[model samples]
Target: MVVDELNEGRIGLEEMKVGGIFPNLKVFKNKVKEYAIERKFVFVPVDSKPTKYAVRCKDKSCPFRISGRISLDHVMVKRFVPEHTCSGTMRGNDHPLVTAAWAADTCLGLFPCPGDVRPTLIRAYIKDKWGITISYVKAFNAKIIIHEKMCGNAEASYRILPAYAEEMERCNPGTIMCVYRSRELWTGGDSTFCRLFWSFGPSIRAFSQTIRPLILINGTHLRGKYKGILLAATAVDGDGGLFPLAYAVVENEMYESWL
Candidate 1:
């Protein structure tokens, strides 16, 4: 589990000093990256191990460096030289520390709502926040990176449908969720996702009680890593708003799939 100190505003890179402690090596590395990116500098890890970490400014002549070692499950900075002799203007357009994952995390921190953010917004946010201009491709890749992190890989999501359906039924009685597999894993020695149909108890009850009798059904194409189709059953509410009823995910929108 990540330590609470890793949360935003709990700690800042400028606060790092000699003998400072970090929850783990990953946090330490990330802090260093944030420090370098924010200052428009570049650092190269001289040594990175399970228990120890060391980095120096990319310019060999620069004195900016940090070294840490693990102690009691936390990394303690043993040495820190916060002095830079090289001109910090070496960075052009983008810094080496500004990776796709870093860009994604920064965008998520600045813009908490994922659905409301776009690649152009991500590019602008990075430029405004870090003074680093990344390519459109990089911003788009950052979007993809965070999307996979928030919503797991498509293939893995399909594999967890059975358990998800079970949990849904347990949490909300009268919920209808079905998962169809191409084959039984134990008996057939393999299994693959074929289709899924789910209708939450709340949505079902709400539609039955307040929605219009007329229902509109539609299917949309999934353009993610895994290709499939999403079928949704929606009803018009008294306010003329669409009320979600049931949904299905299938390989294709065919007669059997609708049934």
Candidate 2:
């Protein structure tokens, strides 16, 4: 029955032999890792070499493992022990559903409207989709990981602000872009990023031509690694739709920052 299920693709099998001309050990290890994930088991690297690699189950109690060595022409499988002595319960951390890629896919459409992408919502979504309940911390971490994947790390993004602003100005003429930085008095090193303000040319044009004179200003506190405030100015269009005019990221939501 197990062999039939493996043959029919109902269950993934731990193959005793893998024949391929892999470019490197990293590629071979990744291929084995994918196979383990498909079989609902976590792959933990035991050791590796220039032409050989070994991997085992993430569970210390589980005795499943495989070791292979690279040959001149192809990768040679020296040993394949496919039997797992585990208790048959999947660990939350090792499960395929609790991954960064899974989180990115789960929160794909909710990137723009961040307010709707709460941990509770993500937990419910996972439960609905996979019938598995994940903890709040896992869900929250997923949210952060997805944001990092989409927009890059918050601190690192600051480092590229100057180039980003310059590129925007070059691509869209008349775009208002500014990046401010301050040198630390004690360190005397490179300038540290302080604030960034930008307004696209098309948004400025639309605000001047079609948007109402009435403008609404709002600010939100960022909850990422670097703490700051995102201040935005918006106006209503002729069709009574909210039109974003400009935005700025500042260290604090003070009167000077608002100005």
Candidate 3:
């Protein structure tokens, strides 16, 4: 404990609570994640690189910085994973911890919104929870396509997010939020996931109707500590089925950040 680090409360490295001690670090992590989201707290992922300099340079216009990096590659979902999931082995599909799948489970909330069944309400709910709204810098869309979108036989490339402190600090130059870029569209195997899930409820029904409702979602890490953006679409019909139509990873949302 930091108390142990200090001599009888005397000044030591610095007085602080021990962030982790028990093997169940996840206990504290869950508390922090929920608190952060509910409080609209933006978390900056720690940079992995050792800082040759004290604090990172605060140049807003630095290309490596958020203010300068107009096209943030860090927006991909892959960047959110941690060290434990992959014994540090495997590539592309090799994260021993923090997969994009895990991120979604966390951000969906401990409970559904009392009245946020509407896409607009869902949008409002997410905005209130994470302090972000629809914008192009973090533009992700959900459009109902006539056909399914499967990349199994298609050419593709995905992002690999940085997991270091220096890179993270630079990525979030303003030092307010973090970006974990990704392309995790949840289109079902059916001809249309949108139509398949109609009539689930008022929320799902209304959500299913929007052919192109801009959806912003985030996946929770397996350890359930981190969260990131997930943009998806749904279909609306007489019965109201809300199926995932399509989606992409995204980032920064200024008042002018509409998709």
Candidate number achieving the greatest TM-score relative to the actual structure: 1
Which clashing pairs does model 2 show? none
Better of 2 and 3 by TM-score: 2
The TM-score that candidate 2 achieves is: 0.62
Each prediction's RMSD to truth: 4.5, 6.7, 23.1
What TM-score should be assigned to candidate 1? 0.75
Question: Candidate 1 residues 117-186, lDDT tens each?
Answer: 5789888998887788998888898988777777666778877889999999999988999999887757
> What C-alpha lDDT do the candidate models reach, one value each?
0.83, 0.71, 0.28
How much is 101 displaced in model 3, in angstroms? 8.1
- Give TM per candidate: 0.75, 0.62, 0.20
TM-score head-to-head 1 vs 3, winner: 1
Q: Which pairs, if any, clash in model 1? A: none
Candidate 2 on 1-259: residue-level lDDT in tens?
A: 1122112222223444544334445445545654665456676778777677888877888887788777654465666777788754466634553565564455656657555567787777766654567777778888887777667787788888899899999999879999988887457677888888989899899888878898899999987688899999998999999988899999998998988
Task: Please estimate how well model 2 matches the true structure, expressed as its whole-model Cα lDDT.
Answer: 0.71
Q: Sorted by lDDT, highest first, which candidate order results?
A: 1, 2, 3
The weakest ten consecutive residues by lDDT in model 2 span 1-10
Off by over 4 Å in 2: 1-47, 55-64, 71-75, 84-135, 185-188, 202-215, 235-244
